[model samples]
Target: MSGFDPRPLLGKALDQMGELITTTDDSQRDLPTPCADYTVSQLIDHIQAVVRRIGAVLSGQPFWSVPQSIESTDWPADWAEGRAATDAVLADDAILTREVQVPWGQSDGAAAAASYIGELAVHAWDLAAATGRSERLDPELAAAALPAYRAKVPAEPRGGDIPFGPVVEIGDDAGPYEKVVAWTGRDPQFAA
Candidate 1:
């Protein structure tokens, strides 16, 4: 995890998103995704929304507390456009290291960078499943994200049982990228 660059992870996510969107056909537009209630389109839009909110935080502004309404029909183009905007925000050196507060938790610029990396990595898996793509994430970023994600795991034990399934096992011989995807609940065999 020492050589980790969060910015590049975000960039990779954006790239993966573009690839998914471009490769998707209308036949798969309405496919259900791994996200509990969201279709592929809805998931894409939500991912974009998160990215936009992160950009707002990076810019030292409050994000999504207002809960603006987004139409389901607007998902595709809007999501791509929003990601482009977020990419621009991340590209700015000032925001790269700037301190800001996010709704989830207070974090410095480095934290913000890491947060996006984790988010995009997870969401990329979701998109990959819905679109039938074999996608993997950066191992170092996933390792860095594990503690953070574990910390945020819900304390409210629903029905005295955690709302999760057994952990997916990656072979010692497996690549970090594969482990990252498996850890994030994505089947690496999904074909796009």
Candidate 2:
């Protein structure tokens, strides 16, 4: 596994997501995102849930026991709290060397963190696209996540057991954020 510390990339991706969450108005909650089944509100809750899971694994808690669904009464606050806690856990250098039980199985912390970063980045793009703020997402963050997606997330045709759907086709000239989104099974041209 790559020994590169994913904290910086993860932080950037989470920060991008935080920005998206902060700007989301209540009227846009029902909008459809590129995640296929999730509406804007549901996607926000899912992001919070995933962040909580990351924190649990990092803290040596039983990650599998964490609830997969988080309520969305006050998403910004909930996301902020989860982000702070997860960020604290990720800040530890030793986490990169330890093994963590991820949804796919056990993996070294570096790989696990990288996978989360990729997941968050792609979802941030989805939110951006749904909310008509796609231009606001950071291309640098998506570029950084591509290597992790390539190394950790399989490119094979997606099945029921896989978290992502089949990868969508994109042009060779597609930008970094578009490539990242398409790699995660979203069409870059997705419109709400």
Candidate 3:
């Protein structure tokens, strides 16, 4: 495929997540999500960390060099800042040609950005499910991310250190968001 510009899709996914975050109540922080190990709060924290790390990669910094942590309070504000920084970095076309270190190893910037786009989109759905908010994640963005996810993520076990579980089965007719989350091993029907 031609070079994929993930910035627009990333922006839409982040915006959808921002809407979902506002609907989250403090009472629901401990609620379970599709990711069996993570509570809603923990998942949100992870999303913020991923956003920051990806921003670092886009900025020509070593992605792992930045320490990742979630602020217990003011997480929404933290997410907004991270999103803005990531957006700014992605806006530069030069980033697409650069190489970045990601968890899977060194990859070109386009691949790295596409990976995060898939991650954020699926996690946004997880957060929405956990929080009992609307399940209407951006289908367009999900569809945009599906190819990269399918190409990179195998059907076999990804390993213990990998956060993703084995791919879950879903019907071929499933919607884009459902297909994306299922590819990440999340049951689309799961709720807190």
Candidate 4:
């Protein structure tokens, strides 16, 4: 409503993740990621599902109406389809102020976009770490999203429906991206 736009930032982050997903080696599919119990292939499926579901939300569909998991042998095409759906709905700035219902609460387009930016940025890091592509990540995604995450999700009383663990501690050398993921309960030092 105040002319704030996080779409470009979200788009850039999503694009980075798309590149990471597309470039992941097939052999790495069974490898473990920083996300507990999620293999590279399973994480990729989760990213795809998140994309499709969020796109459905922006397109005014019920949140739970979309499938929870969408497997993909061709990640590039799957990513493109989700992006295309979101791009179509987000093309108009008018939607920025329009109200949308999310899992936690009702929010306008800009807030929804920022929230998703953080969510996907964290998942993107998971994908990168799972496939040894962490070095290719853009720090801006975490930098832009960290504050929103801190404001929205508390650091204490984790578990249950919260879906996040206690914040992990990182060293002095940790970058913004690392800190952001660490804040979300991921260990930035994880390797595939």
Q: What is the clash count for each candidate, in the order shown?
A: 2, 0, 0, 0
TM-score of 2: 0.92
Count of backbone collisions in candidate 4: 0
Best by TM-score: 4
Task: Give lDDT per model, in order.
Answer: 0.62, 0.84, 0.78, 0.83
TM-scores, all candidates, are 0.71, 0.92, 0.89, 0.94
Q: List the residue pairs that clash in candidate 4.
A: none
Compared with the true structure, what per-residue lDDT tens digits does model 2 show for residues 42-130?
A: 99888888888887886666668678768778988998899888988988888887888877788788877778777888889889999
Pairs with backbone N, CA or C atoms under 3 Å apart (clashes), candidate 2: none
Ranked by TM-score, top first: 4, 2, 3, 1
Cα shift from native, residue 147, model 4 (Å):
0.6
For candidate 1, the per-residue lDDT at 177 reads 48
Q: What is the per-residue lDDT of model 1 for residues 1-192, given as tens digits with 9 covering 90 to 100? A: 234457776677667666665566767767887655567766766765776776677777776542432444555676677777777788777775576786565666667777776676666667776776744434565565566555654433422344333345667876644555555545545443
Candidate 1 deviant stretches above 4 angstroms = 1-5, 65-69, 72-76, 135-192
- Best of the two (1, 2) by lDDT: 2
| TM-score head-to-head 2 vs 4, winner | 4
Comparing 1 and 4 on lDDT, the stronger one: 4
Ranking by lDDT: 2, 4, 3, 1
How far residue 42's Cα lies from its native spot in candidate 3, in Å, is 0.8
